[model samples]
Target: MTQVNTFQLNSSKDEAQKAAFQLSAPQDDCAVMFASPHSGRHYPDEFQSLLRVPLMDLRRVEDAFIDQMISPVSELGIGTLSAVFARSYVDLNRSETELDSRMFSDGAPTPAGERSPRVEAGLGCIPRIAASGQDIHVRKLSRDEAEARLQEAYRPYHRALTNWLNLIKRRCGRSVLIDCHSMPSLVAGRRIRTDIIIGTRHGASCDEGLARTVENHFLALGYKVARNIPYAGGYCTQHHGRPLEDRHALQIEINRRLYMDEDTVRLKPGFYKLQSDMKALGLSIMNWAEGTRMLNSQRT
Candidate 1:
């Protein structure tokens, strides 16, 4: 399961299929799925022309090679989904309604709730800021253009995820989504010593035992682990994490300093070691799935 594969942004001039995401589907017994939403590197030529900031700035926001880090894990009977389109084009983590009206010429979708802090910060579903901490758009976007990004990328991703999870629930009586991400080593110029941050929306998103299972793996590997300090799960976790309904989600954030150089967006010597450890972790998750399966059978 400890296989390595990189889905590079602008990976080639080969004119690859303009798919929004790359999916390594599970063969059977998909009680678990590991997702890397922000790891996509492909930037559409159309999207590139609309941005004001340099590509490197948007690169800063990526989870980098997280899809590669977990792609190998799919072999262990787990499905994997990685966005091939960069988050700068459309963020998969935010709700579709989380659009900023200020970025559009006519108007963006009217949000259901009061405006959120993310939208105000220019980090909406259709983002205004590249990871470089600068505005991403050179000109105001048309509402139709914004809607197309959602129609093309956002809706499809969530639909696939829903179809997969629902099928797993029907087959296995439960499903768990491990929404994976990588965090910057330094926040506000201060280095973050904690290597992993697990979020379960303060115990509401997932069962405590499931969250603990993920945490213990990183801890055993000698990585510093924290819970819900900076991140307490995003939309994927909140929307799907429902232990009462036999669905669960937990967001895992790995400090990028452990395995990559943030400035260069390149892998470091530490990557191999981390990769091996993650392979072991994936196996443990497969075991956990079997354990839950057995427990469900007994309950029935």
Candidate 2:
């Protein structure tokens, strides 16, 4: 069993010290890190009490078992960071400034200028609705409540992620951050479906070659792959990716219908095959990283 270092938050001041993510270190340190920001299933009792929608309804926003699909990557000597709090509670992928002012009773501390298209879409840092479009809270939250979630959850996850990547870069001279996620099978009115979508903010978040390598790997395996279509990465990918600095970030959106029952959020017969494919992909990524590092060294 993989050892997970979990961080639990309490309802008091002392709980604020706990980190917001569960990290599984690789057996051997490498230049790659995998992060599953939305796969968190741990729902704090406090957050649960505030929910206006059913628990199942709120789970619609979750990436479901996406963390598990990529957890085995640690065995390839790549560290894995997964959130311990659900995205509905506090989206780890969103920027702290992405808070929607309308969702709060006292108004947000930050100005509306920080609001982006995502904030308008009801999918801001503190979401206004579940993935199913159901209201999340019975009433508007206080600004303090929103701040607390960010302090306890959002900030720590990103802090740890940033630290992990920086450490990997210092150790290996370059680092790759793979932001993993799962998308709902039925995206608004789409008959043709892709098995995987790799987003690098249309080549701004990572090297074009790296994104192509990932796309080609999935394609070679007979999986339909797309790049920056409906999804072109999110806050994490855009914020962390610094191609000029040798820090690459890639957002991978897996189609939930391929491996699990999206409604029940359970594994199906195809789960094992998907998991196997992911591990293979992870190895391929590591090999590519090694090759890139060698090429860079030779150039130097």
Candidate 3:
């Protein structure tokens, strides 16, 4: 067994009661919604003890500080929803149907539908492993228990996200959802790795123009931007993104090495600079969302 970082055999469901996601700087009728699905670090003392690995080791799979990087999005009058529970608890960016059987001690949970490759790869709504393939529990979970986790953590997060988008669409003619995330510095890329990878589900989720708009924003910053390469998008982009209906979605994957100490999970000297840059990035999207075209088309 991996060394337990914090051991608590008694973690309450109350931990799950904590809002899976948070909304900050809410503008009731904003055209754009920024979401940080991975930047949650509120590890309860009991939950921490249950981890079969060191706390630092468990964090290897986390998108540390992703919420903070995109936090400025709300200040620009855009709505930002961020998850507060670590991805190890429940992954909001994954499809509800993506549940794994291997992690369940009993048979797979009931109501399995639309199983995805992500589920097979161990990254599911109730993930069997963290983003880095770390096993979350020392023992397998019962199917009933798995379902409980999904119902408690995964379901409500999406509910909030969906409600938010609908509200924005009611106000604006349409809504744009930017699913924010961070990636490890290294991957098995065919060529040179990129600093940023923008996934729009091969443009099926968002209009090409809108996708290009975001790509150009990062490009203008002189950051290496790649489109639909190693990461083309995940469950949130695939499930929520609807270009034809005018609801656009894009997934932004920032390289973690850019701002954090991956080994120790600490903020690097570059953290503030990166946050500053992201603020500019967020502001640009806000300005674009508040443009005359979108504002004039709002459902008045």
**TM agreement with the true structure for every prediction:** 0.93, 0.92, 0.86
TM-score of 2: 0.92
lDDT of 2 by residue, 1-300 (tens): 256666543233332345578897754448888899998776777777788888888777788887888877777787889887788888888888888888889987556526688888888888889866878888998988888888888888898899888888888888898999988878666653888999999899998878878988899989999999888999999998999999999999998889888788778888788888888888888888889889999999
Q: What does the lDDT read for residue 211 in candidate 1?
A: 84
* Tens-digit lDDT string for candidate 1 (1-300): 322233455645655456677777775666888888888888777777877898888888899988888877776778888787788888999998888887889888554522799988888898888766788989999988988888877888888888888888888888889999999988888889999999999998988878888899999989999999999999999998999998989999999988998988999988888777777887887777779779878998
Candidate 1 pairs with clashing backbones? 9-41, 9-42
What pairs collide in candidate 2?
Answer: none
lDDT of 3 at 205: 92
Q: Model 1: C-alpha RMSD to truth?
A: 2.7
Per-residue lDDT over 1-300 for candidate 3, one digit per residue giving the tens place of the 0 to 100 score = 111112122224454346556666357666888888777766655556556766666577778887778776666777777776677777777776677766777766656544677777777777666544577677877777667667765777788788878888787778888898888886654433588899989879987877777889888888899998888998788877897787889999988888887788788887787778777877676666667445555744
Ranking of all candidate structures by their TM-score, best first: 1, 2, 3
lDDT of 2: 0.83
